[model samples]
Target: MTFSHDPVEEVARALAASGLLLRGGFSLGEDEAAPAGLSGAPARSILLIGQAGPAPWPHFQRWRERQARDIANPLDSWSREVIGAVAKEFGARAVSPSDRPYLPFQQWAMRAEGLKPSPLGILMHPTYGLWHAYRGALLFENGLGLAEPHAAIHLCDTCVAKPCLKSCPVDAYSGQGFAHEICLGHVRGPHGATCRTAGCLDRNACPYGTNYRYPADVQAFHMAAFAGL
Candidate 1:
């Protein structure tokens, strides 16, 4: 189907209504390598889409609750369906971060939004801070004039407090890298109840995006998932 409006704005608006954001996008050169599953597709451009903050949490929570009645992996399934529908509307292919062969979502986000990693390794958004996430992306056969890459100031470079490093009781994060096993063990232990209920202390300790922090239920959901509950 032919689009009468600017496809990028149209898609962005539609996604926004669903509590998702069209984070940014970029054009892929003809010779640039495509990710594993997309090698055969005539993909020319990509639109990075995702939830930015707590604005999407209520919508997502309702969706999850409804989907949980009958669906396993509600979060992934919901995200795929939402992104898939948008792709179909725009005559593009939908790809998710959770997809096999794992698309370079972090690299894509960095390139698309000019983001840098926080101490915890999560990409620190200029405005959203550590509260944003890339749920999925849309690929089209034809190129759309995507937004220019942002030259946002890297917030971490100036923050002297760096509370994310000091707040984790288990010291799960450090300059050396994340202690995954230690984090997992703590999350699974009784002492992790607070973390399980309120989300990672280190993540919550971030001072940049307190306004965008996920609500309690949403944070609890993520923590439970992290703890494998």
Candidate 2:
């Protein structure tokens, strides 16, 4: 159809219509930050929202253990389709970091963009908690709008005890960053600690966007993958 329209508005409206919430706007410049496939996107605006919940949500600890369900659904179908469309619109393909070839690309996405890796990569967010997840994106030619990322007001910043760093009996998260191997052992090894009991201490400790925590099963599944189970 080749419909001519304001690129940003088109994306915004489309996102809104798809039932994805607009949380905040962020930009990854030529080198500062770029996703796995964003090298090909056209110039377009960035939209941010929690997808379902309003801002100023609760803290992570507030979500109790028994409250979660066993069924796992991350990012929701609507969210996935919307993100896929956005990536395609930008002339790039959305690739999950789990894809072997894209592993380096995923690492680059984090190193280049300052995103920390968590067990949550495979999990999705509901209310921006477990129902939310990021699809490593690449852009071909599309120009993403200049917008600020979701406020760093998330939990990582204000943690006092830093349970994420301390909770892991294996010390998976050293002062520098995630200790991938150690984490794998604890979750996958016969000697591995009971992940279900300890839970994701790091994620659970974070204070920011608590309302965006992943549903329980999703969190466990992601942890298991990181553990290589």
Candidate 3:
């Protein structure tokens, strides 16, 4: 199955300009959740696309500056626009994490990248930590023959301190689950400036991947959106 060009390299090149990296992908199994491709047939492979940290911030900001105020889900919209273009170029279908009746992205992510959820319920990467995200995926009718994903040590398992749980001002996360109202209210309130400007105290406390952590401005943008502010 020789080709004129390497599909993976070509796809990666298309997304690199937008600060989206190919997070790795997998060939769909017969029993796995199969999303329809552009041709409306079940897709055979999926290449996850996302940012490691603040890589997409500049691109997103450029796009945002041109938009009217109060645009809904600006980041998601940007992701779709960027990823959709790459998908169209490759004759693939694009899907986002925010898609309704959402595909099992988390499930697929763990399978594709050997990630597991942290105490904060965000997928914890050994190197990228919680700072990374799965923005969108390109679903193809034929396999791209991507390399197999490798397993890594789950950082949460060995961390005895577990600072992520204790740093939240309102104790928003717990064994029970995230306290949405409590967390939202605090971020939107006056005293929430620390979190609003810096980012989730809990997520920031995870010492595993501090090198890849998001900057304050990037965190502020997401926090503002989360608080509807």
Winning candidate number (lDDT): 3
Question: Would you estimate the TM-scores of all the predictions?
Answer: 0.93, 0.53, 0.95
Q: Please give, for residues 1-229, the per-residue lDDT of candidate 1 as tens digits.
A: 3678988889999898779999888888879986432445667787899887767766767777765465666777878988888878777788999888888999888888889899999899878889988889988777787766976789999999999999999999987899999999999897888898889999999999777888877888787767678
lDDT of 3 by residue, 105-145 (tens): 99888978989999999999999989899999999988777
Candidate 1 has a TM-score of 0.93
lDDT of 2 by residue, 1-229 (tens): 1326754466556555544443344455665544444545432323332333321113212322324544233333334445677656644454544445554543443333334444434222222432344433333344455444332223333446655556566777675666777777666766555575345666565544466565555566556645544
Q: What's the lDDT for residue 5 in model 2?
A: 78
Model 3 C-alpha lDDT versus the unseen true structure: 0.90
Where does candidate 2 have its weakest 10-residue lDDT segment? 54-63
For model 1, what is the alpha-carbon lDDT of residue 73? 62
Please give the lDDT score for candidate 1.
Answer: 0.83
What lDDT score goes with residue 5 in model 1? Answer: 91
Let me know the TM-score candidate 3 reaches against the reference structure.
0.95
* Candidate 3 lowest-lDDT run of ten: 1-10
Give per-residue lDDT, candidate 1, residue 61: 71
